[model samples]
Target: MDVPIKATPKQFYDVFCNKTHYVSNVCPDKVKSVVLQEGNWGTEGSIISWTYAF
Candidate 1:
């Protein structure tokens, strides 16, 4: 899913790629946790895991 936002690419990366900024700040009730499984955040081929409730 592609989302168009008001923020620039850097700003988008800075927020969404900062691990739990989206989950913690935006929708904490829906997401439990986010784990960087294999690679680094904001990097290509990075593996991310999400734990959500409801």
Candidate 2:
């Protein structure tokens, strides 16, 4: 599954890694919210919970 985008690799990585909480803003219809349940964002062994509108 290869999707081409204007952003560089670092920018794409930053969105999923550092800006996970903002994902809902990008696609509000599909993603309700993303919460950090344990540890910290972008850290090893960390946990994140995602809520979908469906």
Candidate 3:
């Protein structure tokens, strides 16, 4: 599921590498929070969890 946005690769990569910031900025209404549960972002085996409300 890849969707293209009007951002550079670095910008896009930065957002996904830091999901909390991106999710908060883009989907603050639907997503309450984002947490990194394990491993450093941009590294292997990284895990991220999102708290959201419908």
TM-score of each: 0.55, 0.72, 0.55
lDDT tens digits, residue span 1-54, model 3: 676678889877777775444766776888888777888765668888888897
The reply for model 3, stretches above 4 Å from the true place, is 1-10, 17-20
Clash number for candidate 2: 0
| Candidate 2 C-alpha error for residue 25, in Å | 1.1
lDDT of 2 by residue, 1-54 (tens): 575677889987897988788788777899999999998888878899999986
Taken over the whole model, the C-alpha lDDT of each candidate is: 0.71, 0.86, 0.74
Clashes of 1: 0
Name the candidate that leads on TM-score. Answer: 2
lDDT of candidate 3?
0.74
Candidate 3 clashing pairs?
none
Q: Arrange candidates by lDDT, descending.
A: 2, 3, 1
Candidate 2 local accuracy as lDDT? 0.86
Which RMSD values do the candidates have, in order? 4.4, 2.5, 3.7
